[model samples]
Target chain A: MSRILVDNLVVTYPLFNRAKSSLDTQTAPLDAGEDFGGAHKRLVRDRRGYVTGVRALDGVSFRVEEGERIGLVGANGSGKTTLLQVLAGIYLPAQGRVRVEGRTTSLVNINLGMSSEATGNKNITLRGLASGRTRSEIEARRTEIAAFAGLGEFIDLPVSTYSAGMRMRLNFAIATAFEPEVLILDEWLSAGDAKFRKAAAKRMVEFVGQAGILILASHSASLLQENCTRGLWLDDGQLRFDGPIEEVLKAYEQDGNRLVGAAARA
Target chain B: MTPTTKIYDPHAARGVSGFLSDLWVGLSMVELWRAFAWDEIQHRYRRSALGISWIVLSFLMFVAGVSFFFAGFSGRGVESFVAYVAIGYAAFIFITGNFVDGCQVFTSSSVWIKAVSLPYSVHVYRSLFRSLLTFFLQMVVVIPILVWAGIRPGAVTLLFVPAVLVYLLNAVAVQYLLGLVAARFQDIGHLVTSIVRLMIFVTPILWVREGLEGARALAADLNPLTHYVEIFRAPLLGEMPRSTSWLVVVVLTVAVWGVVAMVAAAFRRRLPYWL
Candidate 1:
């Protein structure tokens, strides 16, 4: 069984100044003295020139169980991407804890490690390896991925020669070729040509069907309502609501309209 | 069925074990690093007509040119001088390549570092393997030079393999230490390249170590790089390396790794943020 439990998770991004005066500038500057040390003394918040950290996820916490397809709804900079990255094991949290079980496949950025100069066939292997697939595993699924991508002759051509939609098809196919226990997606499958979209959606159904846990972040409420059974609404990096899809969507819409009306009145 | 929990704490593993654990995870992904290394080699020469022959061709020309020019000045035989320069140059390229490019290993892969969940050592290994591949390609040039110089190897020649392993280990330590440092301080990459360039001249690559006498020879003996070069170059040149050179290299390897462990323990987690 798969599970994800986030306890008071806080992720901070340190903003470094142009003059990086914190650490020694020479060989293996190993946290010598003042920088990133000092357990008892509090960090210097504001000084002449020092690193400043931004709290991207400010003490947000949630639990995700097996077979729960969760839709994460939030505005820009509402920590949706940050939450997904944290779950995917990309970003390390600063102040709290995150526990994730089972093997995970992240589609947060499908084009994460692609080389445009390489052909689609080469990219299939490259992307597969980048996503933690072995050579034999990627080889076994090579034909299946190619058939699903339907790039045909273009698979032999450099990705630079392909159109944007074609590139998206290759990326989508490579990502969805294998299913993991936990699947994390940042957005919908809104790429490729019209005909390819139907095939891609069919592939998504197969991928999602096998996944024990699915966390999707997107702006489209209809898509979430159609796919996800549970919903999480975030406001300013805080969990505003976590409930059934319809109820959370209703509450989120009400809150958005109220803010818009208050702005209009002012 | 019951659910399993895997807690990921940013500050969980501290000190030496943290470094070892990360190294273990990165090394576990050997296939990934191999693919990355092969991809780099292919990408570099994919458009060329002769492909990796360019490495051999260029190296051959360089060793020949340098040996001929230096033979005229040093009064040494052309064949022996060519063999010495070829072996020395090959070792130099391998060591210096890892140092100069290893600094950029993390910074160059910032995209993957920020997005992927793999160990940071994966990037370090990829850079090292790419340099290794180049070194192997350049080794093709050494065979003909050795054959032409009639330098036959006995049981002592087997020592060359172990010497190479030590060099590789030291390269890895330096790469990990320098990779983390260079990521935080961007200028360190350029600084490393400049230092390596200067060291190439001082460490006796083109010039023979015996040419310098007395106090000048002591200067070369004091250089750590001279010891590393001697350990590898001496065995291939059909002479067992001095015990002092072997001792210095072993000590240097341990010392370098000691520093690497400290750096890894302290800054391994903060590396992504710095990038």
Candidate 2:
């Protein structure tokens, strides 16, 4: 079976301005009885000017089978978005490896290189080509894509004139035009009014049906339950759990409540 | 008998070859670049009655004003001063526009950079292409005037070819380094613009290099913009560039800045968070 494997992935970010530590004391002089005034002053001075790194992804290992739909659930700082970016080949893993088996189209930011000053038609061509559609294919499907966006009169108007919802509609339409073997979606898909939302959801489901492998990162558990068979739970750059969608969702809900309760208690 | 055909999967593990293939896919994003260039041009001239011709008109007006201004000071004839100042100003504008705009090449598109999975080099290339398009448009305004002034075109004008390529390469290097630094520092973007403004006067754009005094001559020669201006002007004006000096500048530019670019790209993944 075809699959995508990410082995022991680690992404570390170096802290900028390491010298700020040394300079901080210079900016705000330590008081005589402050923490630095005690025995800890020597330790603080010694540690200054040394680079510290934040581990954004730590040994994230996963294997996604072809044609499987997976939901990635996590908190704000969790590695869900990072994992999707790594799979899309945007960010290289600092350690380990990622191997994929098909053409991937990431809907991470549907309007990713689209110019606001360009027309909807222009953005359609630009976004479509970026998503891996050939020029001929984009030309062939131009009408259908424009119609899908439902911005008929405004198609030729600059996208800066288009409302936020209208732009998102155009982005969603162009992104879904090309069939991708591996499809990745970030949280930006949940825009538009009720009517447009229904249309977008239907189109998303259709795209996922044709997608060989799908990974979606969203905070909405209900959406995951409806779309994904498997779920991966991430927390603080670590894979906390991976299992059937229902099982992981249940654990996630409880874990979220526990954190909320602890905060309330404090 | 029915034949079994294998479908090509772009995601398959071809190792380093796969990465290179993906890079090729990224490089094929020239359509995106063209679209952005069109967008920039359209946006700049959107509401104007003169429209895109204003790009040419403005450049012509600039050359005219500077030509007259410098002619009186240099004690040169109107014809020769116009040619010299026009060529110098035109080349300087192209080089500085490319470099200054390139400083925020990625930073200006921070949203897109954070969102897209394409190669970071695409942004640099797009900025360079847009600047080149504007430069070409302005050259249309300058070229006819040069021809009318009896400055006949020569084989030296061909030097523009390699000169443009080197300028673009240097712009890419600068963009890559500054893009990362700007992402981190945030203040560097404003600082770059200020430096560009200062560089305009010091680079001899409105005057001949020979008109400068001793200390000024030494300073101008040390300015990277001097080498770039010489590279383009030497050929278009039928003069040979100082090969040794130009060579040193090119080598230093590529080597010193090239290493910084590699380091920047190596750490580019952290940029989104830093920004």
Candidate 3:
């Protein structure tokens, strides 16, 4: 029964211009004859001489039902992070509505809410608690998470003393320890050596298998193709294509190459 | 399944009821705050040698030092003066710590603030819990002082519980107000810190109220902070607080919460953006 419905969703963040205007009406102008009212007004220079807003998600909408894995493909600043944040309820859309009918958790950043001064085992409890898990829940999973991390005796050491790869292993294990109805991840899953990556990938596959709705934004075509059943291509904050994973990815890569070639020629 | 559509718009019209509901939702997340508060308390003592007991040791030193200097000047016996100053100083640390640290409640937890869906007021509670823990640790120092001063508690001392409850409510309200303001204006944190440091001298934490003759006495009577200190101090010192102290604390609690509710209603939705 778990599902998600996003209707005309829009997420905007202020672009503070310290010394100069951040907005460029010369390149990106409001469409003519369109009523710049309500949720449709994407951008305009405000009277406030310094700060303006960037419309990260502009009139974007999608729907997903149980057991649906949707891959999100977008270039930099194309609103993939903003969309994931919207799904996670961290960023409220400036316009439109989002209805999610299940417990949702986002693994946007595994290192979030972690203290470098805290030991690896303590961080498991810390992150578990921060993610809204109870003390006993974390305690029950502590051994498993520690084993999966493979840090062994080092788990007793503070995270500050651990290497980057070791930190990633601990973070990834803690993040994927719990299963949620809806799972959202933004690139940063790929970590550790090849062998560890394979293990991490296996864990993600199992996590996604249990989730009702899985949304992953990543640049890895193989990761998306291997996991997601459907794909969404985003450009300039707009949904460019939506279809089966292979088809959408094919079109997206073609468009990307074409733009690159054209730019090189010019 | 019916999909519930929720539109998040800071510009949307929000009334008193909306504010109350937001506060209720934040308050109901007891598990989150309990963990966060415990984490705050433990995080400080995690790597230290003496751990959280450091606060108790420090409190003892402060009370002993201040009592040595001021007891003889007050013309009261050192034992009674130590009891008076011990309660006042412990209560002083609790109240002023809330004021100064409350300003950083939202700012310090920006990571959780931007990432989590829990109530913003939960951070306020977390701050209060840390201060309360330290205050309790300092209160342990009071028992011995009370014994030496020969101040036996009567039934009226039970009023300490309600007085503390009221005091905590006021602390939460002020923390919310200051946290929101500080989040918006970073300078306010430093301003609050300076003001709290200055307030120790203006308020009667170390000095006796009876010794203040003219304008100082009026200042002590009018200062909201003085009432907060007395509400907790009087009970522990085995003396009943003046009814005026209770009235001021109660009125200030209501007024501060009223302002907090209004400000939160108007700006709660905008907090993430402001941050």
**Native contacts retained by model 2, as a fraction?**
0.26
Query: Quick one: ranking by DockQ, best first?
Result: 1, 3, 2
Model 1 chain B weakest 10-residue run by lDDT: B1-10
- Looking at model 2, give its docking quality level: incorrect
* TM-score, per-candidate, Cα-based: 0.89, 0.82, 0.90
Kindly list the per-residue Cα lDDT of model 1 for residues A74-142, writing each as its tens digit: 777778888988888877788789999977767676555566667899888877877677788898999
Cα error, residue B165 of model 2, in Å, equals: 3.4
Q: What residue runs in model 3 are displaced by over 4 Å at the alpha carbon?
A: A15-19, A22-44, B1-31
What is the number of residue pairs that collide in model 2?
A: 3
Give the range of the ten consecutive residues with the poorest summed lDDT in model 2 chain A.
A36-45
- Residue A249, model 2: lDDT of 92
TM-score of 1: 0.89
TM-score of chain A of each: 0.81, 0.83, 0.86
Off by over 4 Å in 2: A12-55, A109-113, A190-201, A256-266, B1-27, B211-216, B252-265, B268-275
Better of 1 and 3 by DockQ: 1
Candidate 3 C-alpha lDDT tens digits along B1-275: 23333444434335667667656776776776766778677778877999988999988898899998888888668898998888888888888888898888888777777766656787887788888888888888799889989999888788889988886887888888888988877889999898888888888778888767898799889888898888888887778898999999888889989999888777766667667
